[model samples]
Target: MEIQNDSPVNPKQVTSAQERGNPADVAQSGDFNNSNSKKKKAPDTEGGTAKGTILSIKLAPATDLWTTLKNGSVKLRMEETCCGGVSPLTVTQMFQKTVDLCGDHVAIGFKQEKQWKTLTFAQYYAECRKAAKSFLKLGLERFHGVGILGFNSPEWLIANVGAIMAGGLAVGIYATNSPEACKYVALHCEANILVVENANQLKKILEVQNQLPHLKAIIQYKFALEVRQPNIYMWKAFMKIGEKIPESKLDEIIDSQVANQCCTLIYTSGTTGVPKAVMLSQDNLTWTANTAGKMVDIKPAAREKVVSFLPMSHIAAQMMDIWIPMKFGAATYFAEPDALKGSLVNTLREVRPTAFLGVPRVWEKIEEKMKETSAGSSALKRKIAIWAKDIGLKAGYNNMYGNTHVPCGFALANSLVFKKVRVLLGLDHCTKYFTGAAPITKDTLEFFLSLRIPIFELYGMSESTGPHTVSQKDFFRMTSCGKTMDGCKTKIDKPDELGSGEICFWGRNIFMGYLNMGEQTREAIDKAGWLHSGDLGKFDEDDFLYITGRIKELIITAGGENIAPVPIEDSVKSKLPIISNAMLIGDKRKFLSMLLTLKCYMDDETGAPLDALAPTSVVFCHKNECPATFVSEVLRKHDPAFYKAIQDGIDAVNSKATSNAQKIQKWVILEKDFSIIGGELGPTMKLRRGVVLKMYKDIIESFYVD
Candidate 1:
């Protein structure tokens, strides 16, 4: 009732302010505790000693008390009409509900020794509790961070939920993050315990362990320890460390937790600047999970399945792979670590996930692969594919346009081509296909539409806790991000003639704030509590939201014309199928120019873009009589024929431009494509405009030289 820390730890020492002081001094303070005037009983649990009994725990009501952790309080709208009737349950309580309802359901599956190993909901919950106790034993301070660095695995989920359960922030670090980047997040979050996946991640922490005085322990959840370090524990050893810690102690921390308290920290990808620690509360996760899951048609008690491969550090992946599944009692299968490199499709085929989410690049890759495969077909096969694709596109458009009647020959097309293709891609069971975290091109959407696979587009930022607007089969349109979820409101602030303006969000799912950054928080969430998203958007008459551009990415020409780069870039790529990426380079310049990269093959193992052109690009070159194999060949030769072909494509794109200001005046084909490994794209495949500008500064200036 009187929730106070009985452990030998001080709550005052764990202030959310970036800890730069000595931990020893902070450790010598008073007891870690928080309580209101009124007392409450301990959480009620429902589970007998009998095996297979459904287990559930119900926590006491959240007291009118706030922790002293800096930027740790929730700012959720408590209105019953907001946030889909905003559930007043902590993440633990939410997971417990799933356990009670679907305890015997397969909760997690992982590939090992070429077979799938499964875990039930009850087993998953037990593992999380064990992990929570381990984190506590490892000295995870209250409100402090437990930085999790790894590929998406069952252990990763356990570590994340376990940290929150143990009253600490679960901070997910991108696997691609450099050691310095990892250090920045770890130090910024004041991580007391680092849960790393393997030696590679451990090495990153070890490089800066000395600088992190507050980091008390490092637990490697995978691979054997290569070094005998003092505070470094193996996964098995770490789990056993908390055996002496009583269940009552861990339960007390869980029972004291409120729905509106900071429990998760998602660091921004830092595309433009140092990644800000976006503070997400318990309600942010629980509410968004429940609301968005329902919006996407993930029915409760349904045997929904998803393959987890995208970086869990990102909110999109976190929600799809972790929280949403927990909310609906869905099963999650962990794709191999090399999923992005090429193994994802295999995993998709094996799991046959009911729902699949991919970044724009991921979808584009799939489209390219399909095209490449189609190009290799014999005359007869190619003819049938073309016939089926035509019908598929018609049917897809019919559905999008609300024409309930199926297009003629649609059933035949589905049986002959669409069904076969879906089976090959292991997407036959997929009810929802999603693309987000960046703008997906109309070209990619229609390409999939031609295959009877309409990839739904999701729109949101880390601040919205994952989804604000979601496109589903029921409410979908080409290039439209769809409408907001129930109870979540969107407003267009300072609209222009066409109603395009900075989009703002208001709902319970809105994050608490950026950790330790009051000014930034104020800038993001304004006086009316609306989170002012920097992206520009407008809603249609039907209320479908279409993202126009990002305010920051808008190029102000020297003549004072504001140009959005995305539309121009997408148009140019559509015109030139060989062009993989295009960046409009006319900000503050007299005329618009572009930096283009040829569609090229990428190293299957490393995900590094290769110099050789992709099959589609090769086909383009052959058809155009340009005849180029590698990007280097075209760049080195300055192949007049290829350049002229590209120029012709640009001219075609320019003809559709609304104004000369939006037209591409000149352009250059880069030797390589933009990639995460090349540092031009973030983990979610969102282009890092600032990084690209700096990397190609001289090239950009070349187009403008007098």
Candidate 2:
């Protein structure tokens, strides 16, 4: 299966990679409320008068693959049935019902001043109401998108739900977004009020505030020492303003809300152009929460728990960390933004969460850690680990279709190896572990599965309200992205000779449209109301979806052979642990070539290198950015042995190629990987192929010329 991204992970500057979607890694915040600003007409979306111009960067345009169908097959659709009969529950309504069902239940926990504070479902609902009143007092009106800028915090959730309660649309700005990006989103959405995470985030908006005429007020949740500006308010002060308003008005406002109205605007990770705000209604989120919650079995009786480590701004995080838990009143623990780089694994161990939602990198890191641990063990234990893992791999493959009826020796293998590994990874109780936002290698999935961890790969987009298809436990497929989620409709738009086509969806979960952008909206959602996902995929006879890369990204070689590069790149990285990023370049070329980068696992807590490949881990120190110095550091560790190992890995992957056209015939190791700030990766950690091609033109030419 093929997978890719829009620019999200900003590799160097922000921990969260642009176009990688949201990794929720490193964070750097500063506001831009520029004092002097020109006024300009706001975009078509509802709001105050947005002022100033925005520098919009768009990825290469996408075309519908329906035009490429040879057979002109009717779009085949599938929808699963689940979520016992019930009406839609808006997020606000869900909050109310959850409070009623279990007012005393611990709804959420967040660390503050070195202590974790717990809030009941009732307290959370009340807090949201108080925040809603505060937003109303600030003159925020219906559909006036309110911006919440920060890392994942209790305050972020409060502001988001509060804005919706106050009859405004909440726009979540990625914590890694620049002042310019923050300004563009704030203005484009015409945010009347923006709740900043802390002083740093506030400072980012403040530096560019003059340019946003529509912005009426700024609220800082974590910063309390400073005096408030005329339009700025602190957390305590802001809540107090809400107290002045009678409680009856808040109830009335909540009761008056409808599900059809747009509640949130999730902006697409803009790799090439301006991030289009995908308008999702109350129904979209509610239905998604219900269906997804049911499919994943997140219920009160299930004893569910989650580590909210992903970006709250992302739909995946919103669904898993927020909506799903709200259904059963399960608890969510926020991973402190500052501690995420160092404390995530430790936190997971302590939490021992029942659900672990991660991107591919998180799982890969876990796998790498397990391997390191095994490698350091005694010879006999290492042999046992290897034997058990091999046994599990065979059993895992058999269990891909259904539960395994393994030999009695399997239990011994689990006792000797698998169970202990699961405990060390802090997933002993995890039943709903899944990887999204990026494509996880089949090898990674199989390894975890063999370890007795059921790791399902899901498929969906923000346009489809997070996930539309997920690998199921009852009817699993190793490579397929499960089946169409219950209550969602999925179809393949057109078929090639092999039945590959663009994946499309039509259901309550599909987004309403892109806010005020009719043409783009029409392009995305056709007359039949199908949400056309530019991602290409196919459905097996049993109806599981298999993604096959972006239509725009498909490389047609000089020999006129179409090759999907994701699988080949994934194979290379899977076999070579040292390689961090593998970008294949063969568009219109005679043969496939690649650029590789090494991983840098820094011990963030102690300022030491953690990755074995890092010379700074225990060797010499070199922090300068000179290419020669970087190259030396990379080549220093990648000696003849490393070259042979890399070559061996390449040779193995090339052997799997159906034909020579699809194989990576040549490759060059690079000192650095594509970073978001470098304009080489999307927020989702997807390589900006177009940008990468241009930046490394000389290196690419050298590949063929040499």
Candidate 3:
């Protein structure tokens, strides 16, 4: 895949060696050049020993070298057995073991047709076993792929787990995927069975089924569906056939599973080109859970509640909702896919969850809502809020990193201001919140931190199992992604004056390799064992990792200056409550420009009364107001502390940018937010850059015309 440069830098133009820093001189020099070519001695066999060679700084981007090292370790790690030297088991085995141990616990909760339903651990296990038995009964061979097409439902999880249990690799088809996209993955993986939730999902599969020669059967989880094809079977009827087998036989099949076995085939949501199917082994996932558990030191009994809403198909959600909770024996409350607005508030109130995970967009929305409420309060109430916020910020910062003991005057602020704010946001029951999957604005992070809500920023990708780094409650840098997780090695590939480069990871959690795409897999995981995370990042003096942006996403201006769009977009979006998505435009242009999409909170008719509810007489425009005005109002209400910061950002871009690249010199506000259903976002809620560019081609073109 070609890395598109929207900024100033021409990707084809490589940086000269003389401009780069020597790795030998840095304090983390050993970590930078830990390639196998140097023949360095392995570290002690003890768990904490740093056996791998330290990285050596190099001038060129170290993508190829890192991939080699990571591939080697992926093989080695999979070969190593866990659970006291029994035959090595894969991630699927670990999941099955947990279900076996806790069959009666609540495993999944969801709303089916507007009624809440739940699956006990035993029921969940039984369903998976049944599905697996059905697959095996249908003669599905080991390593064959099965595609699952559905929304968030218990059946989706059951089919996913069943695919692995049956010794077939499971591939997920995003519920929101187009028929063509689904066809691409099914054909690419050469899937044998397609498991779908309902007739609607089945239809999409049918559209592309003719193109897939390997497809042997289609299974529908829902009953009473009209399917004329002889190859299609109802989920209930298929399970009945599996039920004929003795229970002990199913248990035996599960026990015989091994760690190196292929389990999941996840496709990367790359911004450009066809997605690559990532092949992950059971060992890869289990090791990831183990390493992540050690890093966070999660207590099963203490912090048990998690509000799960992110798509399970995404690796981050799987880690947070499935693996982490399973390992910790924690309870997770699933939210309805359509009820995110009300379900979020209701779930928190009902479950009083202690931990939750969200993408930056979710938190940004929360911040916007809070500001909207605060916009028209009385003068006296505003004064009280400001005072309370100050006290809360001080105490919150201290409490976050373990400095909960409030000083004399600070105690007054918490009682008067901060405490109320927490109650207002319905976050009074939360201990901490994890934000990841995309870059979060510093202002948004600080605002929650100030409100005494512990927002711990984390970073990772599908290829890495899940999160590789998370900020410790008390020890966090505003600019950093957090320290590397335990059992993982991290370093920069090439250094500029800022000591930043492509972030490389060598750890037990890396995936086995991409599925079926040997050349691509080899390219991603080189001969060594280090995974080349394409993210550009830098380390501070304290070793905290700060992600700048995707190396491929960096924009080079016509002035020869490279600008990372992530930070800039994050900064702009954080301050603009009405804006949900913002893409930086103009590479090789004099300056940066942007295309901003407004987040639709409520319909104009539904929200117009809110403006009347406000004490101020500011007129409500018909969703056609200047984007800048809407953004300014949002910043003024939500983040009063960052007024100067927001102004500075706008001024900097305006002054340095050429007419084309200048600070969105002319822009339009999108009437709706980007969403998966809207075809503007991917399943993980990541903006589809190409889709957005195409959809808004006219608006973008208008900026340069006359």
Candidate 4:
């Protein structure tokens, strides 16, 4: 693969569907030269030789966007014409192929009235078309956004595909986003229609509707509307409104779309600052979905099953739930809205999915639950379980380190404990288990490995269209993200003596620049066309990528030591079983200090952290003979036992530190745990360091007081 700087073809000249011929004919045309730009090597089209044809792409119209981009538009440049084995099909063509191949196969499944209801590929396509027509009838303008604020449901999927089908940008707003955040995204894309999940989401839209001049209508997909107003329609009514729209009109718009034009806008989590809208083109979605699906070995025609419960606003969930399933003809089951609050395991058992991807936090929660359950088991059962886990760990380490020999009693352990544990967790049928979005601690990874479950790690960002590097079963490593998928290239921008540097990506999956943020886009994709990932990583001898730390998260102490906080924080949490979160402080200070939050109970309905201690925390307290049952109780009475136990854990962590600069000199426990509601975590549960610094400014400042 090769990328270079060059002048672009005129957007006005390439806007028409007739001028921009289908990319499928690239092998035949052999027009590899892109206008007057520098000639670069193009990827081989699927089933073709190592040569590709030129694809003229028209940039998206600048509507309600900020940009001083080249030619006053976001740069929709393709460094390579096609990627390895990628067909470069548009979203419409790709979905059409799947429908043609598996028209009668189930594509989506949802629970209704205690029974699983499914939609076939043909039926799903029809629903998307119906929704597209409705969007057209509601006066959706070309390139304008259609914001969908909801959980992962059939309606959400339909609206997502429908907007793109009708030549509009599909913008997903995080379900947990505040009304103000929602307004920022909706207005940024100049949304013409907002499809919300229920009355609660509708109320939020309604609260800000008066301020949105571009919003023409709002559709509520679930529950009865408590307030009625003009231009507000229910799901069934919204579907009917587009009946008068001609099918030909929608078809014309769909046909006009090219693989390089923007179709979706994924907003960042704003952990650093204001969220940037990531412009993903048709090629980005289709190529990434197909390539990544194959990397994980997704079976076709409903052979593969997945539970969709993660936030769709994030690229990971959207790609896994909607895009990948569509590409491979896999069946997707929508988990309930409260799936994360302890109901996901029940759904997993019923569906018996073949593939599952959970963030680090979700996996941690499951690990905690399993440990709590094990602690409550009968003495004999606990003993047997421990024995099995010991055998499991030995076998797991052997396999991970490339030893073919299975440990003694492995078969017996699997049957007696591992199999039962998998069945109880509804992961018995799961062959591919994945964890991503945030760095998972080695402790959590090893715990799952002890159960004969190896959770692979995937590494990528929204700009890379997800799954830049994926750890497959055969290409597994303990803490490293596996090598890049076929056709993608990875590079360490500038290496230190230890070979750590910014991880850069080059592939068809690279997005079409950040929407309306040309300066930021230029910063992200350098002159060489490599998309610079701000993450710090280094490749091992076998080329596996190990994420060391994030460039922005590195803390430079006053003593001139550059310390990575994640590893140290993970170490602290591993030593202290009761600690929920540990943040390393002392950037530009004498030594490190820590702010911690204890494991506490949370309100399942609202996802609010409660004052009471969680079951796992209580178990820790019982084992240590500390009688506190609530976080407030510990704070109200600084019990020496609890403090001593925490101090011992910190001391253990510090003893393992490389130097004095890295050791935690002082520490304080926060009143509450970090959470999305508390403005400390992102939608995907990634820690918002910027938000945390501001929210606890006084506490952090006091740590530096001499």
Query: Which scores greater on lDDT, model 1 or model 2?
Result: 1
User: Which pairs, if any, clash in model 1?
Assistant: none
lDDT per model vs. reference: 0.83, 0.71, 0.63, 0.82
Provide TM-scores for the models. 0.91, 0.83, 0.79, 0.90
Once model 2 is optimally superposed onto the true structure by TM-score, how far is the C-alpha of residue 456 displaced, in angstroms? 0.9
Model 2: per-residue Cα lDDT over 44-70, one tens digit each: 211111333231211111122111111
Candidate 4 Cα errors over 4 Å, as ranges? 1-85
Per-residue alpha-carbon lDDT of candidate 4 for residues 360-450, written as tens digits (9 for 90 to 100):
9999999999988888889999999889999998888888878877778889999999999999989999989998999999999989999
Q: What ranges in model 3 sit over 4 Å off? A: 1-74, 78-88, 96-104, 111-118, 222-228, 247-252, 376-379, 400-402, 405-428, 574-577, 602-649, 652-673, 702-706
User: Which model is ahead, 2 or 3, in terms of lDDT?
Assistant: 2
Every candidate's CA RMSD: 8.6, 13.1, 9.8, 6.9
Off by over 4 Å in 1: 1-71
- The candidate with the higher TM-score, 2 or 4, is 4
Enumerate clash totals for all models, in the order shown: 0, 56, 40, 0
Q: What does the lDDT read for residue 590 in candidate 4?
A: 89
The window of 10 residues in a row where model 2 has the poorest summed lDDT is 24-33
The Cα RMSD of model 4 versus the native structure comes to 6.9
Residue 498, model 2, lDDT = 86
TM-score: which is higher, 3 or 4?
4
